[model samples]
Target: MESRSKAHVSWCILLEITVAVLFCSNAQAAPLKITLDTYRNCIDGSILSFSVSCCPGVELDLNVTVVDFIPKRDRLSGHRIRKALQCLTGEELRTYTEKLTRAYELMRALPSSDPRSLHQQELTHCAHGTGSFVQDGLKADSNFTLDIHSSWIFLPWHRMFIYFHERILQKLLDDPTFTLHFWNFDNGLDGRTSSTEGCSEPGHFFPGIYNDNSTSTFEPSRSNRTRVLNVPIDLTFPVMFSEADPAVALRCVNEAVPRNREAMHLAMQKGRVSRDFFGIPFRYGDVRPPMLVGGGSLEYFPHNSLHDWVGGFMRTPLRATGDPVFYPAHANVDRLWDVWMKLGDGRELLQPTDPDWLDAEFLLWDENRVLRRLKVKDVLNIADLGYSYEKVYDASWIFWQNSTGLVSSAMAPTQP
Candidate 1:
């Protein structure tokens, strides 16, 4: 009878363990939810409702606050920018590129589920939560390229990229509550500081805090102005060259060009320029020689330079790699343009005055098409595109009447 009791006890313990395992498995199977909102305030002085859609459950009405974002500070200063560039051994450069390539692949492979699909999933699972939207053909890799030439082309490409990414979040989560906030850097008016003295403010709408040491400065200019080969190469070069191995391209940047923090710090000197393929010189600013014009110099300088400048020289054919940062940098440039528009006398600049600029067309996509051509007049008013950014200078600050007005007006407001 004692032996029979011992066997029965052992069986009971085994049954308990199985039950515990099943319970834990069920707990781990919960679905994910996301939500996104705009930065503007509502009628109650709360954050404005940009849009709020969600996946899976009951949606709650909440006010989201929009604040200025800042990048982490870097300590390196002066000639460090040039020194860093020289320090980039070919091997280091290769590794850095590889990592960017991998990031591209991962972003591209994100599941192509829209808001409706997520909502249905939520109903089926009976999960309680909200999430952001997702969209089609909205992968991040499509924008990375050192080969981009015209500032006009570069700026719009990034703007569209940011818009598409935000739209994707809205589609996936169906939460219009989700909104993207940008870093305000004009004259540091918002009191938002950057980790790198030479680094410009981050632009485009990115969710969450990102602290990647991917910024570089090559002095004489506020940022490095490297000219890349303008000649287009076979779009399939990366794929074909690697025997269609995605790993090959990723390895090139990841292991070769590890992020160079010190070098990045050194790159932000005044009067620095980077040479691209065939040795074309590029610099920052709107001045005659393109002086360093960060922290708000004037519209005629860098603002005009952005539209007038073109990438020159072609040592070799250029191919696109999948690095997400490329688009953000250009987006930063566009944001600067937005700031410049507010600084000017609220008058539109005539592009037709410059023959070369007038003939140029910016290639981009509208909401319905793949590639659409736009002119200088098409994008001048970013607000028309359904977005308005917080001014670096508040209305309480002095209003500038001209480029020089930035200083004079700040000292004393122009009374009406």
Candidate 2:
């Protein structure tokens, strides 16, 4: 009764908020004109500038100014906007699979020592190894290990990693327009805007595009089959996983839709600042590994869940590259970052402006076969990197920010 009552009230609130905020005056209302440079701050408007002192020193302001989403007109160049593709249908999936296969074939043909070599690149930049932290001309203490996961560098590091990988596939295909597809498990393979459940499975569970071992792009060394027992590899984050009981599984199945939505919600809505959204804040001149800090809600939820579900080799932090799906999975993660950036009435959603974050640098192999150093601030704009994701999703996701657990609690599956 308690659960049902809560659900009933929430449903009413959802309908009211959706009607008022989403529909505005008429049923066919335009997207709220974002008042740029304006912030819809909390009543007790205050923030902690995680700059010189790390994450300390709160300032109460008369108003808040969020990290603004820069308009295209203000950009220097927009020539190479890479579209992150989605495998919504067989034809669409096949197109991406074939292109990815060809790229893999060509990249595998490159000599191992060549920076552009597929294996070499993954190991050097992504996978963990005996000498993972050692880069040319850059030295770290022998005991120091560079783990992008659990560290503040996770976001920017993977951003560059996926960008470079996309470039490799494009160059090898000899098609400047070639781009990678994203395994959008959260939105399902059909990739529609329906707020329905069961889309994450059958439709996307261990996506068929990456599961078939016969394909060059679908590696089999470590995968779903080998996933550790009792592990929630196939589960979406914030939708916690359990086993041994059909009732539990069913309950989980029921909540997947809303929790998945809510996870995206909290990652974007509650995680308003960089320290909150990206992970722990990195301080200026900070050369040590992140101690008490962990990943942000974004990284912990869908991001890590995708990696876990793509288990086997993907389960390992440093060696998941063997699985071809890693790129597409990260592409989806990257897409969400763009999605978060553009969400809200150009008001609530924001990014961090800490000098440590903006100035952070990582390395990657450029398309010219040269080892090039890239900065975190450089890849802020996908167009700047010569890529842009296909505009997907309608305004439905924007409506549920105020939906406080309407689906997760009462929707649990019960035994007959």
Candidate 3:
């Protein structure tokens, strides 16, 4: 009897040791480097949205040289003001799977009522609620909705959401540097506006990472979620008001069809000013304009179009976050803002400095799972939050399309 008890104790000890080793091995696993081959599974899993900062990538060496040319915007901007990582390339998306999966898992794991949770009922309310803080007191009424879309809340609210989302992801992954990749859908494989890479258009290419049943990044949706949506990311996908002329889509076969490169040119060139791209910084005047305060060209075209193109579960804004692409897609839009701001030596394009624009408020979950209210002014500089996107025009080779030298799309020069 004593021998039998001793043997059982030994077995239990062995099992515990095995678990410890597995945890250590997984935790200490060298950070995966972003590579073209890497994303074939999760590498290019069409993140279309976000990741953690301080994560591994090919930017280390270049950081040595370019840190000189890159102006030090702020002590903190160094961290938060990340160059929205473009999803056009597969690298960032591949390395980000662990972080992305962990974030989604944890958020979903939380109770639905928690503002951070992504459960259906809560998301449904928020969607109809538009942009709002569903806390006590102010929003006591069940039907009291805060439509934060359009005008000012658009950029600020989204930024706050992305910030909390990124922070939550960082916690789940336990890596502060984890960051999200912005879907640079407009740019092509070569980071040139004119290059024609097969299935490489922003609207085309689906990250095969998510399609594979084995990958954590994959999210099963009715619309062959894993299959790449080979069409161009069409900005003219929606007809807006049923009454509006469908013919506004210049060359599309049908109102619902995707427009060609010409449509992209119009979206960029016509709204060559700040207010046009970002919309009036503050949309809430004395009389609140109806929801959808006439989104700017940026919001109307690339932003909305990408959401529609990544259809199925993500077809509607309410359920958009259900798909991972939503993050990188918004990151791409944010990157465009950076691109636009940097044009003509940074003076040409700039967000509004009005107190209203700066003082905009939005609610998001902090790392502690507590609901935190953040002002639009607080998040303007991502670097303050501890990350920055890869250098815009001169991004590292991690985003290269080929062996020689090629930058990714959506990040191509403003000029043709």
Candidate 4:
């Protein structure tokens, strides 16, 4: 009996040792996940949206306000600005992004996920409550029903959303240097707009590899068919936004769609441009009144020239929600504006002759009855904004010039 008891004790000890080893191995093997704590350390001076005179080693801790996921009816109708204020506080934004970044990290860590996978999921599942804005209950036509005049609201709304998400990442991972990639179209290397690249299979970067299972359905009309090239970075990536490294940011920028100048020119030449408010479509070519150009009146502004202007006009329900690329496409347009401002000789870019286009009343941020108008020249230098972005292609590569005079639809090889 004594010997049997001793043997049992030995077995139990051995079992405990094996379990300990197994647990340690599993802990070591697990892929690194982006956590809120990790995000905090990555904060850098570049991520601050507003100006700060004094630099501190620790970021300003956010003051968060908890509210319902959606705004209350009274708040939505009665005091929209106040409600917006409730939603737009620093803490709320940080929490929102932290959750989003966590979701992205989870998706990325999955065995077989990629940018394409995330896109398909966004269209079908509405990852960010984007489905709330979908009018037709169809994922494919998400951006189709947006109101044109709501550019004022939509721009701020999306920017706020992005900001909130970024803040959450900063809070979680403790990284401030982590920044976002603004899609640039001015140089025209984006994969989406360029026919030389397969418009349907747009590229993206993942911190790690995963199997891509997303399916693509092709369409003939640019509206009916989704263009994959120049597709925006999936709002979802595995890393917390604050934890994302410069390389990751660069990859996101590099994968964006290139602008299609020919397509844009043809669309404009055909007089398909129109304007709208909120989600409702207005009269074609009548959105903005004639502006003085070279001491004469002109209906169209050179700055607004792009293929999307045509698509923006001809489509009914002028605001687009069905297209996954809409936000990114607009972002690319904004990026081009940023790039052109940088390259167009800073002083010359701000000479606003068009009254409709260059009105002083156009305010980027309005608080306390003080309106701040953003000049075309002021945005020309993003570096002055304390942020610089990576170019689409490497500096060593030859610039892509559309001098062929022939439009060919083929996927071009991506420059490494």
Better of 1 and 2 by lDDT: 2
Largest TM-score belongs to which candidate? 2
For residues 1-416, could you state the per-residue lDDT of candidate 2 as single tens digits?
A: 99999999999999999745421223431211112111111111111212111100112121323232222432323455333343255676577678778888888788765566666655543322212332211332322223455545667667878777776777888876776766654552233435343222222344555655676676666544322332222334222233333433322334455555655555555454545666654332223233223566567666665554454556544356656777777777787777777776542234656555666555455565544545677777777665666555423244446554543342221100
Over 1-416, each residue of candidate 3 has an lDDT whose tens digit, in order, gives 99999999999999999745422222222211112211111111101122211111122111111111011332212354343333334675556665566677776776654444555323522332232222121333322223444444466566556666666666666776666755545643344454333222333344544445554445566244225344334444442322244532322223222232334444454354455656644322222223444355666665654554455555554456666656666676665655555544443345667655565444344555553545666777655655556543322112333321111122111100
Distance (Å) between predicted and true CA of 179, model 2? 0.9
Q: Model 1 over residues 1-416: C-alpha lDDT tens digits?
A: 99899999989888888744422222322111112211011111100122223222233222332221111121111111101111223775455344333333333454323222212222211111010211111212212111122222233334544554433333333444333334221221122342322323222112112123342211111111122222111101121122344532221222211111111111111212111100121111111111111122222222222212211111111101112322233344456545433444422341122322223232322222222344433444554444544333221113312232222221210000
TM-score for all models, in order of appearance: 0.30, 0.64, 0.59, 0.30
Q: lDDT per residue, candidate 4, 327-351, as tens digits?
A: 3334443343333334422323333
lDDT of each: 0.26, 0.50, 0.44, 0.26
- Give the top-scoring candidate (lDDT): 2
Q: Count backbone clashes in candidate 3.
A: 44
**Candidate 4 Cα deviation (angstroms), residue 298:** 17
Instruction: Provide the lDDT at 22 for model 4.
Output: 28
**Can you tell me which runs of candidate 1 are displaced by over 4 Å?**
1-107, 110-161, 172-178, 185-208, 212-330, 345-376, 393-416
Q: Rank the candidates by lDDT, best first.
A: 2, 3, 4, 1
lDDT of 3: 0.44
